[model samples]
Target: MNILFLTLAKISTLKERGIYHDLMREFSSHNHNVYIVSPIERREGQKTTEKKEGNATFLNVKTLNIQKTNFIEKGISTLTIEKLFLNAIKKYFSKVKFDLVIYSTPPITFTGVIKYIKQRDNAKSYLLLKDIFPQNAVDMQMLSKKGVLYKYFRNKEKELYNISDKIGCMSEANVKFVLNHNSYISKDKVEINPNSIDLQLVTDVSEENKKKIREKYQIPYNRKVFIYGGNLGRPQGIDFLIETLQAKSGDKDVFFVIVGSGTEYDKLKNWFDSFKPENALLFPAIPKSDYDLLVQSCDIGLIFLHKDFLIPNYPSRLLSYLEFKMPVLAATDSNTDIGTDIVKNNCGMAVHSDDIKSMINAIDTLKKMDGAKFEVLRQNSLNFLKKEFQVEQSYFKIIEA
Candidate 1:
């Protein structure tokens, strides 16, 4: 089988670890020919290029900056990406007949590209629905529900959904949301297929190594460390995170580490500069290997989502926390089931993003937890990951489609 994957994520190589990379590698390892088409944003100063690594072929198409760019350019890039990708597929993979076409959401502009593949090779289309788009923009107040831009993307979203043979949502809430909102989509077509990764055996960091990491980062060894490592954008509800930090400023037994960069980094930076909170430390995005070590050294993992979101957003960062056997503390909108899942599995605690009192209390609870119980929560994190988020599960789901 020749599997074609289309994503907005920049995948320069299969050597890197990510949801898509792991899934594609699974296909490649199963003796399927996997072809991945991803972007090489103009900001990267790279041209369209193709590379073959084992059974997988990577075709990186050049386009306007699609991620972390200003609104105008981002919009233009989204609108034009389908055409760019279509042209690249025709030029580079003209002779290949794809058995399956798997794509994920964000731009919601892949209807044309998918339509072409379905017609050209009679390929089955599977949507790895990672995001609920224009509506999420409306939730963030970035897009007006009554505006033309919203209507256009909404139409695109419908087209993409309509064309997909199957839609793999991140959670039950996601499947329910799609069915409830889009009356036209059949229930049989949607299922829970989450953000999964190729599981790797992680060696527990030695106590001495953990101490070395804490010393290197200037983190206190006596205090429990709570780390949030991912996009610090509007969707993450950065303001609420700041409020939580301010509320915990006087705490002596717990330390907060916020890492990652995005549009909201400056806002967080400003607050950190002004308050100089003694209990917290702020760092911009670091290299992945270093970040992995940092996460391993932490006692707890933190997740935050904007209070306004109506979409059920399940961040992939939760998988990272689980992979490292760190208990989670998610502050999210009511719509997402991530918080619910965490608590139900006894992996950690969850609270609404707007509930500063609850968030603070949850933090305190974790901080005061005894060693044996804390270790149980950590083990639960890994257990949940293995059960729900392994790459083989995602591979079988797509292949069975």
Candidate 2:
């Protein structure tokens, strides 16, 4: 089978670890030809290129900056990407007949591209629904529900859905949301296919190495460390994150580590500069290998989402926390089932993003949890990851379709 994957994510190589990379690697390992088309954003200063390794072929198309840019550029990039991708696919993969076309959300502008391929090769289209779009923009108050932009994207969203032969949602809530909101989508077409990674054996950090890592980062060894490592953006509810840090300023037994960069980094940096909270440390995005070590050294993982989101955003960052066997503490909007799943599986605690009192209580609860019980949570985190988020599950789901 020849599989064509379309994404907005920058995929320079399959050597890197990510949800898409892991899934494509799974296909390649299974003796299927996997072709990926991803962006080389303007900010990257790279021309269009293609590379092949093993059974995987990568075609990176050049486009305007699609991520972490001003609204105007991001919008222009999103609007023009389909045409660019279609042209590239025609020029580079003209002879390949794709058996499956798997794409993810964020742009939802792939209807034209998918339509072209489906007609050209009679390929089956599969949507790996990761991000819900214009509605999420509205939830963040970035888009007006009554505006023309909203209507245009909303139409694009429907067209993308209508073109998809099957839709793989990240959670049950996602499936339900799509069915409830879009009456036209048949229930049989949607199922839960979540953000998964190619599982790797993680060696336990030695106590001495842990100490060295803590000393290197100026992290306290005695206190419980709670790390949040991912995009620092509006969708993450950065303001609430600041409020939580301020609330924990006086705590002596807990330390907070916030890492990652986005539009909201400057806002977080400004607050950190002004207040200089003793219990918290902030760093810009670090290398993935270093970040993984940092997560392994931490006692707990933290997830934050904006209170306004009606969309159930199950952040892939949760998978990282689980990968390192760290217990999770998620403060998210009520709509997402991520918090519910964490508590239900006995992996950790969850609270609404707006409730500072609950957040503090949950943190305190984890901070003081007994060793035996904490070990149970750690084990549970790994068990849940193996059960729900292995890349093989995602591979079989798409292949069986």
TM-scores of the models, in the given order?
A: 0.99, 0.99
Give the least accurate 10-residue stretch of model 2, judged by summed lDDT: 66-75
Model 2 residue 383 CA deviation in Å? 0.5
Cα RMSD of predicted structure 2: 0.8
Quote the positional error of residue 89 for candidate 2 in Å.
0.7
Per-residue lDDT over 45-126 for candidate 2, one digit per residue giving the tens place of the 0 to 100 score? 9999999998899999999998888778888899999999999999999999988999999889999989999999999999
**Taking the tens digit of each residue's C-alpha lDDT, what string does model 1 give over 155-226?**
999999999999999999999999999999999999999999998999899999999999999999999999
State the lDDT at 231 in candidate 1.
Answer: 92
Question: Which residue ranges in model 1 land beyond 4 Å of their true spot?
Answer: none
| Candidate 1: pairs in clash | none
Best by lDDT: 1
